[model samples]
Target: MRRRGMTRRSLVASAAGLVAAMGTGGDAAAARTARSVRGGAGGESVRNGGDESVRGGGGGEDRFARGEMRGVWVASVANLDWPSRPGLTAAAQRAELIAHLDRAVGLRLNAVVLQVRPTADALWPSPYEPWADCLTGVQGKDPGWDPLATAVREAHDRGLELHAWFNPYRVANHTDPARLAASHPARLHPEWVLPYGGKLYYNPGLPEVRRFVQDAMLDAVRRYAIDAVHWDDYFYPYPVAGQVFEDDAAYARYGSGFPDRAAWRRDNVDRLVREMGERIRETRQGVRFGISPFAVWRNAATDPLGSDTRAGVETYDDLHADTRKWVKEGWIDYICPQIYWHIGQSAADYAKVLAWWNATVRGTGVCLYVGEALYKAGDPAQPAAWQDPAELSRHLTLARDHEEAAGHVFFSAKHVAADRIGAMARVVADHYQDRARAPR
Candidate 1:
């Protein structure tokens, strides 16, 4: 998720101060120790000198070599992270992408989640959607080369797993269909589109819309050697304040058996996840499916099974994404919840939430990777904890206690590069001394 505006100078100074105070010469030694104790991805366990055992919720043991998923999200919507901005030459765009990948490798990270489809558009050649506007500043205008294809090849060459990220329903940031490409699917099928909260979305209620989106996203999975298929938290467009999603027509048409509108919406998202997972496996047996959902599923005050959080928004109730159900049913290969909060936050403490998710994925055969808010670190608008360079590093230190906490993915690539508060560098110094492969 994007954040409020940030000035780089002060944050940089803060990071420098922290580094100066802590000293940096011992980072290499610390990392070596971490590798030895944690066992570099797929390495022999330090304890039993054999495969590491993952204790399941049902008290079963699933054995595998210990590995961590150290990933960073490269957002493409509105050119937030890559291409620098729209209309850059293809050569320039490729250079910027290569730089991001190189930076990830330098950081000892193992995975890259590139947003190929930010809105209802494609970053590669697709029969289902037009070219992403972030590539050339004009929807449908080819950017002279395929970004996804290049990303997959370049990332793999650098020994990094490239996960193709897609936003399932978001069509456009604006409500005007006229701004879209002439052959845009949303424009082609008006009935499938809905204007909500100043943005346009393909109504999730329609069966055809769901199937078409699955087809659109799965196209890349079939065409490229992508490591995984990834989806962010935008399932139903976090409830708009005072405005409705306005999917009544499709709901009226297909909401026959569901308990209510919320249930029907959740079922729509569930079908998308379950069916997409099935198709991904069929398309490529080795390809994994994952979702990085909003951290809280439901506050304990609302549901007995929910996390002990007082979060204002719940994925289950507000966005109609039954994140917990998806994990229990094993619909996704991994669940990386965006626990974007501080350690001791009153509303939703990071440690408490991490524990909740650690338990949620246990025994389910699904990997759990915490999504870190790299963007928040040192941001003046954020809470005081974010101002501390050690804040993000502390998050990793905290995750070490959870057996199910396989790894973590930072919010974005730009922050990884900026290391504004030296937070990313602090994390590298403190926790990521040894590079770990993404969990299988």
Candidate 2:
């Protein structure tokens, strides 16, 4: 088969690796995806990053997880992807969103993890918090319609599962309570929020804050037919240099029983994850509750069971997100760790991270999906390896070797649409040669 846009270097290396088709654009992307899904449009063979006979490579018959959770994140904060910018008419907003879902389906992906709660605010009309600034550029002003409801309808129509992504404790990207809506939960209960790293966050250590955020998010879950309730790697937020999270007042008030502050913080986040899981199951029996945590749980230097990498941050240590424990205990239905690194990365090898995560969820019933960094590919700020169109594809190639690596979710939607340097094209040709089912 012709390489199409594939660069010769990657094809020689064995090579590497859109839309809810709504209109013309959608039709084209969907056509490409349909061709791959329907037995590779005549069972065309693909040469993948030096592996000629691997899954979905030759005869396109060995594709994994036809039902796997293939997904992409549609970030709303700061106008990263949709609406192009904030304050678009409700009609325009809906169109942009449908376009994203169409893009996902066009790429043969079955899921879209859109950020409904970008910064402790709602993309939809919610009683818990005001409409997100990401939608109207004004915290409280409603856009006259619910984005989440529209998203569910459009996504389902395109045969894509919609995962409502929430940031449990984040209040705002800035550290000002007065600027918030008058009835905003954070403003009303300033004591429940903590200013850290120039940002405002609902104090995870506060019991009231935890329950309130859960309720706020669950309100949306109960109202929508979303396939999953998703949380990103922001449980306690990454640490800031020369600054400490001033939860001492909270710790003193509620953490007297724990042996230390770290344990108490871990317990706080643990409750959020555990209780959220239980509530999601109770509210919607099959609505999968999942988390896409920071890739590194803990460095092996600190814990032998940790991955063999020297990431500057650890979800368990700094962010207080016990990602591993959640998997072992089955507190989450799936763990989509953001292993956004290239293969052979010195600080965090994509191959090693995947293997570590594979072992992390081995027998736990929790599904495993590595969060790929499509956004990193070809970005000048990224390491030199990311400049290669095949780097991201190589990561997927490596993942095929791991039994527990169920699937992958790309970082964001725009990168896939860009197909920078043909990185995404390489992947479509290699692994996603056929349509697959998204895991529940």
Candidate 3:
């Protein structure tokens, strides 16, 4: 992405706000400095550094505060991020994993959201699901060692928290399950899944389906030493333009009190999220529960209290995800909004959404971590804001204004590995160079 350089007019406009606040008094000046530092769209460490250096704060092990979380997503589907070249020897896989962890350790990041079960498959040994095809050339053929166990063991060795990322409702991503290995879950339990929007997803409205997904996922949580349980933005599969999610039968049978099909669909997800949180605590108290939902929940046009964006599809209306409700109700430990846009874009402005999220997370203990769009930072089609090396830098700086904004987690690991436009160097040199805050 080719971003525009910071304009003098924009800088002056930003300074004007700071100056107005500072003119009040010494206390106001300190607050203004903190706000100005927080208001920039820079990296978190750089923004936090201004706060620390300005206040003449001391640094030590004390800098690593308790209850802080920072991580990157390790996607397995299509080999999107890690395990760079697929079908590499087991030794190569292990080596690549170590290198990724080394970067995270060097950056002082505390967590790795590795995709163990990208689809309805296994990254570790399981009787219920077959081995992930993304791992080995063919499905059901093991890639050698149990990936989850190896990932957990290796991550712990380097003092990094490993979160087992799971796609709760997704089955065969795009291809038909008849094309899948005979032993794949979708083939074995065709009745449990429904094909929708050119992809197969476990019928969310079915109780048996819900229980099965939880059982398949919780098995890993109980067996592995994972530090957190993570689910991403694919809650009911982002709505297809014209096609509807084929869950009519599941809802007709399951829906009793719900008035409409939409409400029933949302309740199914609510059940899964609420029940999953309770179950995680029941199984592993220390393992956190987090969801990175779509950036906009709803636009103010739809709801009076919604965000000021004109996003056509929102998590609340289109995807049946009450993301803000979950955070307000304390159903999740952390909320990572995929605020992947520029400063003044018409749809889903990054800065506006970040402020909305910070304000929404006011009373709840839920932590807010802006999910960086690392992939777009160098892509040609991305907005002008992403091209600037300092675009993401300014984002993190802006987020620091919120006390609840604990830290940041970029989308995937490989993009940063490329060091596109020196984005990685800027982050490490500026902030993560120091010791990280301790785990909660």
Candidate 4:
């Protein structure tokens, strides 16, 4: 999701307002509470169990009752969270990153999912792709320091897990290939790129493109000590009105045996997930792989196994990501569904979606960490529920009712720091009373 145009000053002001709303003794009390929660919540140890197939149904042991996956996404795309904006000095950028890590530690959070490869570009020196434009405002120009490497080291030192987030197919926000760095893989191999819905994406249907993207992402896995490799819900771009993905050629070439184009597309994504999981294991054991997909898989009206929601987009039908299937098949280590809604909304109730996911991963050993919309907490355009400071905290309380709910990861770091309307602060007061370790 795109970030709101809230300024840093405004975010700080809102955080102050939150403190006032909390009626705390002041910053000192808050700091004390944060420190107190740093202790681990005792329970079963959940670690990466390799690629073992996790099977069963809703009735099974809750393996992650005490563990948690508290994380915040440090988005680099469009400079939503980190770097403040493009073109900052390398020292300034490093300071900004350190501030974010410090903020996580103060909040008693245990993980930071930093977007190292925002748009098929590298935050580190990758032989496969150019430097990310978000680093220096010049796609191919090095920012003079290694962001992924520094992030991993600093995070581990702070006792926070650093998950390297990557967007596999997105090439650029714009459609102009000439605007990209000359060394950009998308520009060099034009046939592998597709301009769709005003953005450029590497064609997922091509075998070579799939393999190349994996190699590019794995380059970081091979270099850094990142706790996990995370992907957002951008597998196939969300459907645009009246526009088509225009993968006719790739489909025709590789879609021979599949019954239809939709099935073929799903298979393409499945291969990417399954193959990436295998390759990640081959590259580094104990390095987890996870996807934070759009909440709804399918509406019950669409399928019997689907959630009881009327979401506009279904990951199965629109994005072609069989997220539920991935969990059942044990292709990935964990599943964080972006249930970005309120407790009792009409379309996709946060509780309902959480319950659906809780059931989906019950018997499967895949951990369930709810993806929260902290960005929506005080968004004026959001429903009234989000305006209430207690909305997000209520979500955590509701999630506590579910046996399979391991933890939660907020949308982007800005909102967590923003604490707009004090929602995030309220969440900490209500639910994050105890510091928890990230589930394996």
Candidate 5:
């Protein structure tokens, strides 16, 4: 099976105007994603993420802030990057997680964005959600240890920030609720669930469902002293060919005079983003709320403000995620757009997208982190570009040209340790030689 990777937008005055039109309903529910583009597309060197002196890994516990974000994701779903497999003993799981964090430190990264809630479940026991099936291979069964607790302690000891990751609306990877634990929220409240593309998602359009999902996620926030609240590109699920997300009933019941279903759907996601941001701020003043959205917000042909990419699947029209608006409205602390393509690729050129995002995040107080696709490195199945030993490093080299390009986060942990084709080695040599804290 193919492993799925991460993917994210743009600017400020017109943004406020757009938000005003979207209505005050989003005021309480939005994520902290405001942004602006005062500068043009060229990148100046950023401070925390240095460009010079790329050698040596013994940058021993640098006391000063680097002002850049160097993070690695430790995905837990289906054992993509951790635990090796489901149902591992509690001691074994703890050891595996610690090893992943140690690997991050070895690579000179300062943050571990561990997925605490992959697929609408919790790594830490939660009153509102079931124990993650990814850990024990059975929903609601404890792995006999609190992964989040161990992660926070270990990451902090290494001077790394532990960002709690959540997949807000996903209930199950498959459509049937029978496979879910009997006490799972989806099974208890089937009305809030919708099946599309063989997966069950809590309908984003339903106000009650949105609130429930938020409350469920916030349970973790109140329980853990996490550095940030992180989400990925799963807002409305990637568009499936010939398959429609059946939410006509939701639209008819609550869309309330919106001209089209698309507008209503986008508003639903907007509310979720806005509210989550407000809640995070209220709960923990410094805890960041951020997202790693799909690369293309829209093709240039689709929207005059869109990036110059032509591949397909947009965040706005297809996934109902207004990525640009989130950045513009100050609904997120950071936006990590997974620019997982080669420098000169035909569909989505990495250089072009990087320039566009740097320009977009200039004045918004929101940081920009490039989501590097380390998983693709040295993979023969990938495009010929990734086959090059220096492909990943070249991405870092290009990012150095953008001032807003605060730092880079590799897709998952295992790939970085594997150093496939020595691609990761090249990136470290060229960009991460000096130990740096995650960009604030």
Candidate 6:
């Protein structure tokens, strides 16, 4: 893929409307968040950092209920939901973040899974790679402030846990390296990347590649006040239509005693997860580690222990992410499967997967937080289960039904902003109205 050239004016025009909708830019709340910073402990505050005075009636009633790991993903690629556009000014960017936090606090969300390294870049000051293109027009141009630092401080003032979400293997959303800045990791170390599925990714099969990615992400955990090291579902890129992953070279070089390539890839990810978990726990004893894997582990026909779904792509067979293994072995602190499908859909049924995950994670000492499909909550084009106003609420109901299922995190932040299904409003009014103390 060739690099697409863009001018700053074009980016400004593209994002102007988005910036306007982010409200009057800043308010007294924004000023409070700004003033909340005070360089004290663990880079910032612990999770669910909210006001101590505003006590409501609902939180205590739900104390017997499983405490949720509520959060929303703040995606930066293509400027999906944050920074408005590619070249937002640093002030505008900070304002946008404040608005996001305000929404998070308003909805009574316990955490914010902000994307720190969406691709092989940084949202804050970093010595390893350049600034994210999503922050400024130019990739390496400094945004004049540390977004991670400010976010940590402000989020803590409001008492929200900030999990620095990292895309472990994703290098770029596009396939062009020349488009990236000269200092971009892909440009600096071209051999470490492999272009596939219309995007570039660090080859998960290589030992050095695995170590490099782990170290780069762990560097953030070590340096910042990140409450957790969170990873999304980009393990071995979700299968391309007809193309095969181009990792034969690494497999040939490193697959020396493994049974096959599949096992080797699983080993590579497993190694990354285990080592990263151990490293984070060692560096920050309170930092939690979690993974949001694709919903189904495997079909029951494929494996007797797997969920009863007909999904074409299973986490184990296709992505090589043995998520069940992670839960069973107690490697992850929590497991959030993206149960995006409806109740009775045959492809990947939500109820079946939830039951399976709930049963599997009951006593493993790993918390289970179902990843609700907020985007599908009330879409008329979707199945009847989705169109129901209580669709997501029903999922939350299912979460409540489970022994180990604690809480949920919506897919993207923008969805919660829409008030679709009225689920966010419902949770706040009914369950999370008061500030429940943080989990011990």
Position 147, candidate 3: lDDT: 78
Q: Which sections of candidate 1 miss by over 4 Å?
A: 1-64
| lDDT for each residue of candidate 1 in 1-440, tens digit (9 for 90 to 100) | 00012122332333344434546843433332222223213211111112233321122232113456789999999888997999999999999999999999888788899999999999999989999999999999989999999998888777788889999999999999999999999999999998899999999999999999999999998898888899999988887779988887888899999889999999999999999988987887667788999999999999989999999999999999999998877777789999999999999999999999988876455778899999999899999999999999888878766777877899899989888989999888776655555565
Clashes found in each candidate (C-alpha, N, C closer than 3 A): 1, 19, 18, 2, 28, 6
lDDT of 5 by residue, 1-440 (tens): 00011012223343444456658744422222222222111121112233323222332232212256788988988789987899889999888888898888887888889998887788887998899998889999988989998898788777788888899888888988999988898888898899999899999988888998899888877777777899999998888888888898988899888889989999999999999988987876567788999988988989988999896888999898999998877788789999999999888999999998887876455778889999998999999989998998888777766767767889888898787699988878876767765654
Question: Which residue pairs clash in candidate 6?
Answer: 48-159, 49-158, 49-159, 49-160, 50-159, 68-407
Q: Write the per-residue lDDT of candidate 3 for residues 1-440, one digit (tens) a residue.
A: 00023332443345455545546543433332232222222221111211221110122233323324557888888788756756888888888888888888777677788988877887888877888888776778888987788888877777677878898988876858876779877787788888888888888888988988888999987787677788888878787778877777887788989988888888889989999988987886567778888889999899977999999888987889989888866677678888888777787888889889888875454667778887788788887877877777676666655555656778789986786887756766655555563234
Cα lDDT of candidate 2 equals 0.77
For model 6, the superposed segments whose C-alpha errors exceed 4 Å read 1-66, 437-440
Please write out the lDDT profile of model 6 over residues 181-257, one tens digit for every residue: 89887788888889988999988887888888887887788788877778888899899898889888898899989
Off by over 4 Å in 5: 1-66
> Residue 93 of model 2: what lDDT?
88
TM-score of 3: 0.84
Q: Give the residue spans of candidate 4 off by over 4 A.
A: 1-66
TM-score of the candidate numbered 6?
Answer: 0.85
Ranking by lDDT: 1, 4, 5, 2, 6, 3
lDDT of 4 by residue, 112-192 (tens): 999999999999999999999998999999899999889988887777888899999999999999999999988889999
- State each model's CA lDDT, in order: 0.82, 0.77, 0.72, 0.81, 0.78, 0.74
Clashes of 3: 18
Q: RMSD, each candidate, Å?
A: 13.0, 11.9, 10.2, 13.7, 8.0, 14.6
The total number of steric clashes, by the backbone 3 Å criterion, in model 4 comes to 2
Candidate 2 lDDT by residue in tens digits, 131-176: 8887888888989998898888877777777889998988888887
Q: What residue pairs are clashing in model 1? A: 56-363
Which candidate leads the pack in lDDT? 1
Name every residue pair that clashes in candidate 4: 46-440, 47-440
